[model samples]
Structures are given as structure tokens and as C-alpha cells.
Target: MYYVIRYGPAEDNSADLYMDPIPGKKVSFTRGERLGTLPLLTFRKRAGDRGAFLDYLGSSPPCMVVSDRFVEALRSVGVDNVDFYPAQLVDEATGKATPGYQAANVVGLIACVDAAKSVYTLMPGLPEGGAIPKNGIFEFKSMHLDYTKVHGAKIFRLFETTSTIIVHESVRDAIEKAGLRGIRLIPAEGLDAFY
Candidate 1:
């Protein structure tokens, strides 16, 4: 159930990819590096970072989920704002995407479901909300996991949350690999043209 969310250079000026988007950015500190690493399917949480291993790492405050190792790793790598609340908030919402919805967009929160599993997940996500762009997520090849085979293509409700992310489920296999190509611009940085 581990996943990676990374920020990459935008091929075009469609979406402005800012640094912090996931609540994890505000907590884990290492989250950005973790997400930026490529081939996420093979990514794993840093050793001693799991909830049960905290004691061996150090005596963290009850409120601190961000581990010392995580912070050091992020700092060493020059990345700040690794948060953990984004994933937890998804659970707080009880499988409905909203609690972690990004505010700027009406419905920024989403539940990315892997249709094969028939359930939404919180493990893998876009590191910075801006990398995901405010719109045109489906423009490129991304696996859309819809157990119900939702008919409304590129249309759905985005949940609401202060600690939010635009959750989307794809059947493509972690994510749909549409293959990088060209760019197209539109209001809200629409998907690259002919993606």
C-alpha cells in the first residue's frame, strides 16, 4: 500500500507546479523526496518511519507523526514540507473524498480508486497539488479505476478539505501511462494540447 508522489518539470506552461500541495508536505518533511523518486511502484517508506517503529527512532511527541529520520532526509535533500495529514485525512473522511479536498478548486479532494481493487486508496498521490494541475488530469494517459465504469469522463465531484488533494482513481495500473508528448494551454492551465 506504499506509493510515491513526485513533482516534475511541466512540458508546457499549462499548470504552475508549486512546491507544497499534500498535507504530508507540512509534516514528514521527507515526503517531497519520497514522492519525487521515480518508478513509484518500487518505492518504499524509509526504514523506522512506520508508526510502530517510532520508539526506536526517538521519543517523539504524541502529536508528531513526522519522524526525525524523515525530517533529516528531507532537509539533506533540500526539500521541505513533507506532510502526513493528507493520507490520514482521507481515512478521516471514511472513504469519501472531501476531507482532504484542495480548496482553490471547488472539489479538490478525490478518492483515487484502483478499479481492480474496487476501492480508493491513500498510499500513492501527487506530491504537489500543482503538479496535478487544477484541471486536465485525464488529458494524458492515466489509468482510471472505475469499478462502476463511471460514464462521466472528466466529470465528477471533488470533495472539500483544508488538507486536501484532488483524489482520482485509475484502472491503468498505479497510474495511466499516456506517454509524455506535447502541450496545450487553457484557463486553469488546461491539459497540454494533444497530450
Candidate 2:
């Protein structure tokens, strides 16, 4: 079974942090593209707050920044579809840099969602009265994948929704076993309920 990974609930009175690519740094992690070189990024921590660092940090435009522990756990489970790039989480308030984090890019695209079984709405056409494009982009109400097309992929960004990250059951097990923080694995079949 596949799972949708999302950030866990925030701690009370703690800062909610989000990563952002530094100005002029090109980022393509969300599109499943390889970065020839590392990009400069920073985590903007909310002001006047106390929060512990988390194993997973989410970014704008929907990218992932994971702790080294997360990377190691996935590797231990033989997950190879993801590439990691070195990144530092610089505190916006103190300008302090925290290491042991990496920008995770789930490589490859898989158009594996079973549209007939999934609940979604098509995006409007670019021009008025123009033909609606049946591409990956859509407003998903509930997504069900064609597992046959997944081919045992442990982790990937769905071609039907590039911003969504899907992981295999084994991967979720490994993450849970490792006691990783800041992540929640939702069963793909139960996604509709959450929405």
C-alpha cells in the first residue's frame, strides 16, 4: 500500500519553520528534476517562539528538507528513488546555521493514479472555452493509484500531482521504526476522509 506523507501537528507556542531557496538560487526539487549543484536555502523560523528542530521540514512551492536520520532510515530500507543535496537550516532570528539536514528530491515521475477510481476535478483551460487539458495537474479530492504502474516504487512524486509525495508501506514502517519526527503517514485510501 502507498501512503501520503505530511507534516505532523505543530507544538504549542513553538515556531513553525518553513524553508525557502535563497534569492537567485534556482530550485527544481518539486518537479523531480536533478540539481547539478547544491542550492542555497534557509529555514525561516517564526519569531519569538521556542520549537525543537524536526526531522522533516517543508518548504514553499512544496519541497522537502529532511534530517540526516531520515535519509539514513530510507536508505536502510533500500529506497533509491530519492536524491539528497546538502542544505543548512539558518535560523531567521539569530542567523545561526544548523547542519545535518539535506534537501530531498524524489526523482522520476510516475503517472500511476487510477483516475477512474480516484475523485478529482480537472483544471480549467488556459483560454476561455478552450479544451481542458487532461494532464497531471488537477484538484484531487481523493487519489487512488494504479499500483501496477508503481512497480514497487518506495517513494515518488505523483505525475498526476507533482506536489504530492507518495511512499510505500515499507518506507513508512522504516520511518516509524526510526522514531523520526515531523512526519505523518496517511493511508492513501483514507485521503478523502482527511480532505
Query: How many clashes show up per model?
Result: 33, 0
Our tally of clashes for model 1 stands at: 33
Off by over 4 Å in 1: 1-104, 108-112, 115-142, 147-195
Q: Write the per-residue lDDT of candidate 2 for residues 4-84, one digit (tens) a residue.
A: 898775642223567665566766777887766666556666555466668887766556888999999999989988888
Residue-level lDDT tens digits of model 1 in 62-153:
12222233334333433323333322112111232222211111212243333342222222353423223232233222233332432332
Off by over 4 Å in 2: 11-25, 49-51, 126-137, 193-195
**What are the RMSDs of all candidates, in order?**
19.0, 3.5
